[model samples]
Target: MTEILLIIPPFCYGDLSEAGPVYPSMGIVCVAATLEHAGYKVKIIDMFAEGYEESKLKSCLEDPELKIVGVSSVSATFKISLNILKYAKEKRPDTTTIIGGPHITILPDETMKETYIDYGVLGEGDNTAVELADLIIKNKGSPENIKGLCFRKDRTLIKTEKRQFIENLDELPFPAYHLLPMDKYRSYGVYDSGRKTTSMITSRGCPFKCIYCCSSELFGGRWRPMSAEKTIEFIKKLYDEYGIRHIYFQDDEFTVSHERAMKICDWIIDKKIGLTWECLTRVSHVDNELLSKMAKAGCKSILYGIETGYEEGLKQIKKGITLEQAKNAVRLTKKNGMIAKVSFILGFPWESKEEINKTIDFAIKLDADYSFFTILCPFPTTEVYEQIAKEGLFVPEFNMEMYSAMPAADSLIRTKYLTSEEIVQMMGHAYKRLYFRPKYLLKRMLSLRHFSELKRNFKAGLSVLRFTVKSMGKKAKLAKTT
Candidate 1:
């Protein structure tokens, strides 16, 4: 059997990572599950989980049995991911190197420019990874034959025919959680209690044409999900085998099909699978019945992307929801005893200061249990990124590091009406305004049910303060410069 190594490079997740919410990479873990099931010896190195020890990575690279080295990365971590593979090649020239994830999937040819990477897997890697590994390990077939793959051959980059999205998601193996450092995962302040918490994706893709999202491109703009039975089984496996007490569903819209979601909730209720969970979904996809069932079946939190406050900004972003719908969704979520966490993005290229302020005002007025205000990050492969690129909207200081959407981080692009610095300052102001309110603080304090909740709140609040102050300093500097 061929020994395969899959790596997730150390990437800063900004405030999220700073506030202690490290998670396993679902992409690589899924790939590992498929590869492991296919009889390959697979090892997963989560650099972030293990604290990025160069000596450990060096040791892994030295392993003679490691026939293939694979890495997964997003736009923010592409540079580090590339450097890792480059170093792997330098250390072990015999090992075949591959890279994949949103960044490489969007720009295959550009990623292949680094000769260190022998192949790039586009979109979902579960099936593609297995086929590629078999071909490489057995020297069985040409790289050109593999769909959803790109490679440099004879100094020419070749991307094969587009791979179809996996239709029956249930056929795919559950993510190989055993390969991950599961104990290292945490979800403090975001999920209840934080202990034994991990993230799962029950579905893939988004049907809505949200301009800032790349899910439609990556997952074929369809909502494909595992059967409710399979989903329950996976959840049970996590609870029983891994002792996972809390789960954060990383779905773009977990409640896309209310029927399926209701069935899932029913199973959790019937089986008494008592693990509390949280998920992200569109405002319109959820309603009173679903919220009621979700709360009963251990859904402690629900996060919604209310991208902007006003109607025009929402339309511009193709968010496909009205302010009234968002308000109703939040109201229902909280009414059903689940925490409603809403996120707003400021700094659209066409947005005026008043519009951005309106978004902040809306967030405060909506009064969800948690509110996150982020500056717009124009990720590649999204409609917003294309628009920004076409219009030369990116700021001079914009870089991949700012792609994490850290409120304090420099905005990547500027609107006609606002500079990047102004956008970031507004993000700071949004946080300070919403979080520092005596009403919000009193509500949070009253809602605390445990010491863990209090500790998590304190830590999270401290993180927000630090970021807010950092953002305010940038504003002061900008004022001086002007």
Candidate 2:
């Protein structure tokens, strides 16, 4: 057995993965398990952990004892990953530099053309990474026929056939949480209302074809999920080992299979592990019965993608859900004693100021426990990106650098009726209007059951206040930076 180091690069707001700074990369952990199963020494360096330094990154790459190094990043952090690859190639020319994650999966050919990136693993990396390590790095054999991989051969880029999706997700090992900084995620305020928090993805892909979403682009529309048995076993391990009381299910569409979700809830109740959880799913996939069962199973919160208010906008974006469905889902979640949090986006290419206002009004009327608003980021490999590129509306300077969905003054694409400045202001206004609603404040204050709950609420309010001020200030300067 030889050494290999897996890296998660830091990006906007110091986040390294989509689960935020608090959660380790399930993808990276899966790959690590594959290597470890093959009797390889592996170490994972998630840079979001507090005590990480830049010097350590260079040293990790420079270590000759390491046989191969894999790095993963999303669309927003592709440049950061590329820079790290360049440094790795410069320091240890012999070490293999493999890039994975959402970025290269969507644009493998272009990404592999970069001289520094030795290989790009598309989609799920567990099987592909293991195959690559066994053949290319460990055995020193041929790289051809290694499915779901892209690399340059004899100065020409080559991508193998796509690998089949993992059919039996239960066969995969539990995420290598021991290789991660468990205490660091807890200290970072990652959970909703639990003492210790972690995340789990029971499924591999999304079934929907939402145009603005990258789920289909990266993982495809095949929704392969672990069985209810696996789901229970996973959470039980996290609870007994890491003291994870609140597990956020980061599945793209958790309730897509209604029966499976109900069974999962039943299993949770059967186990009585005292582990409260939260989940994100589409609005239409849930109903009153499911919501009631979820609450009974200790679900504390639910999130829906209420992307727009009007049916026309929904049609344009292919959200596949009517505004009524969204409203009912939120109402049911609240009625069932679960926190109903929803998210909305601003600066759609076809959205005008009036349409945007309608969306904001709808969110306030729904009165969910929490709401998130962000400027539209037309990321790569999406219908929104395709439309903007076809119209030549994307600003040349911003490109991939501005793919972050944070409220920033600069937009990567120009909308029909709003400038970059107006979009940013509208984002801030959305936050202010939603958070400052008298109804919202009264509901939240009443919902606080304990003195410490009130104190946490106050601190959260202060945090939002500071963010609002900073977002407004950014609206006035840096017209082209994130």
Per-candidate TM-scores read: 0.95, 0.90
List lDDT for all candidates, in order: 0.84, 0.77
lDDT (0-100) at residue 134 of candidate 1? 88
Clashing pairs in 1: 349-415
Residue 202 displacement (Å), model 1: 1.4
Candidate 1 — which residues are off by over 4 angstroms?
397-408, 475-482
Looking at candidate 1, the ten consecutive residues that score lowest on lDDT are 473-482
> Candidate 2, residues 1-482: lDDT per residue as tens digits?
23788888765542112223366677898889888887778888887554446697776666667878788978666777787778877888888889998878877766776888888898889988888888765685567778888888899988888887788899998778888877666322322444677678999898888888888767767799999878888888888888888777888889989898999899888888776888899999998899999999989888899888788889989999999999899999989988888988888998777888888888888888888776787767888988988877776676444543433434676688766666766666677778977878897787776665666667667766655665566544423211
Per-residue alpha-carbon lDDT of candidate 1 for residues 1-482, written as tens digits (9 for 90 to 100): 23898999887746545555677889888999999999899999998777788898888877778899999988778778888999989999999999999988877767888988899999988889989988988787878888999988899999998899889988988898998888887775545564598889888888888898888778899888888889988999999999999998998899999999999999888888677988999999988888999999999888899989999889999999999999999999989988898988888888867888889889988999888777777767788888888888898866554553433476788888777778787777788889999989998899888887788788888888887887876742433211
Candidate 1 C-alpha error for residue 189, in Å:
3.9
What is the alpha-carbon lDDT for the whole of candidate 2? 0.77
Which residue pairs collide, candidate 2?
A: none
Q: What is the lDDT of residue 103 in candidate 2?
A: 78
Tell me how candidate 1 scores on lDDT: 0.84
